[model samples]
Target: MKVIRIAAALLIGPDGRTLLVRKRGTQAFMQPGGKIDAGESAAVALVRELNEELGLIVDPTEAQFLGEFSAIAANEPGFEVNCQLYRLDVAQDVMPAAEIEEVVWVDAGGTDELHLAPLTRDSILPLYRSLQSA
Candidate 1:
C-alpha cells in the first residue's frame, strides 16, 4: 500500500465558518488543501495548495500549525493519507477557482451534513469543536 502525504488548511472566516471544497467527481467535502510535493515543507505545500485550489493567497505568518493525522484515503483505494493541518484566517468573500466543484462553509456542529474526508472528520473537526468552545 502506498502512503500519501498531504497538507490542508482549516480556513476560518470571521463568521466562524470553515472553508470546505468538494473536488471534481468526489462526494466528500474536505478542507481546502492537497498533496505535498516532494521536498516541499508541509506549510509551503499548504500555502501552494490553497492558492491553486481556492485562489486564496495565504500568508505563511498567518498559518498556525494544528497537527498531523492519518487515515484511509478518501478517494483512493489501497492507500492511506497522512495529513498536516493548519488553521488560518480567511476572507469571507473568497471563491474557489481550480479543480474544486463547489465550496461550502461549514461549522463544527454542521459537519454531519457534509460528507467529509477522513482526516477532516477525524482531526480537523475536533479542533473546530475546541475552538468553538474556547
Candidate 2:
C-alpha cells in the first residue's frame, strides 16, 4: 500500500469550532491541508496550504505541533495517509479557494452529520475532543 505524507491543520475559531474542508468533487471532508513538498518542513507546508486552499495567512511559528497520525486514505483506495498535524487558533475570516470547494466549522458533537476522511473521523477528531477535555 502507498502512503501519502501530508501536513494538516486543526484550525479552531474563536467560537471553538474546528474547520474542515472538502475538495472539489470529493465527498469526504477532511482537514484543510495538503501534501508536503520536497525539502519543506511540515509547518511550512501547512502554512502554504492554508493560504492556497482557504485564503488564510498563517505564520509557521503560530501553529502548535500535534504529532503524527496514520489512517486509511479518505479518498484513495488501498492507500494510507501519514499526517503531521498541527493546531492553530485563528480569528480571521477565510474563503474557500484552490481545490477546496466547501468549508465548515464543526463542533465536537456535530461531526456525525457529515462524511469525514478516515484520518479525521478515526484519529484527528477523537484526539481533538480528548485535548478539549484536558
Candidate 3:
C-alpha cells in the first residue's frame, strides 16, 4: 500500500465555522492545505497551500499545530493519506481559487452536511468540535 503524506489546516472563523474546499471535479470537501513539498517545512507547505487553494495569506506564527492523522483517501482507491493538522484563526471572507471549485464555511454541528475526507471526518472534525466548545 502506498501512503501519501499531506499537511492540512483547520481554518476557523470568528463565526466558529471551519473553512473547507471542494477541489475541481471532486464531490467531497477537504481542508485547505496539500502535500508537503520536498525540502520544505510543514509550516511553509501549509502557508503555500493556503495561498494556492484559498488565496489567503496566513502568518506562520498564527498557526497552531493540532496533530497528525492517517486515513484512506476519499477520492482515491487503495491509497492512504497521512496528514499533519493545524488550526488557524482567520477572517471569514475568503475567495478560494486554484484548483478549488467551491468553498464552504461549516459550523461544527453541521459537519455531517458537508462531505468530508476521511481524515477530516474522523480526526479533524473532532478537533473542530473541541475548539468550538473551548
Which model scores highest in lDDT?
Answer: 2
How do the residues 1-134 of candidate 1 rate in per-residue lDDT, one tens digit apiece?
79999988888998898888898999988888889999999999998988887778788777898888888888998899988888999774766778889998888788777788887888778878899889
Residue lDDT tens for model 2, 6-113: 999999999989999999999999999999999999999999999999889999999999999999998889999999999999999999999999999998888999
lDDT of each: 0.85, 0.94, 0.86
Candidate 3: tens digits of C-alpha lDDT, residues 46-102? 999998888889988788999989999988889998888889999847787888899
Of the two candidates 1 and 3, the one with more favorable lDDT, higher being better, is: 3
Off by over 4 Å in 3: none
Off by over 4 Å in 2: none
Candidate 1 regions with alpha-carbon error over 4 angstroms: none
TM-scores of the candidates are 0.93, 0.97, 0.94
Residue 85 alpha-carbon offset, candidate 3, angstroms = 0.6
Residue 39, candidate 2: alpha-carbon lDDT: 99
- Arranged by TM-score, best first: 2, 3, 1
Ranking by lDDT: 2, 3, 1
C-alpha displacement of 133 in model 2, angstroms?
1.9
Model 1 / residue 108 / CA error / Å: 1.7
Number of residue pairs clashing in candidate 3, backbone atoms closer than 3 angstroms, sequence gap of 3 or more or interchain = 0
After TM-score superposition, the amount by which residue 91's alpha carbon in candidate 1 deviates from its true location, in angstroms, is: 1.8
**Superposed Cα deviation of residue 121, candidate 2 (Å):** 0.5
Lowest-lDDT window of 10 residues in candidate 1?
90-99
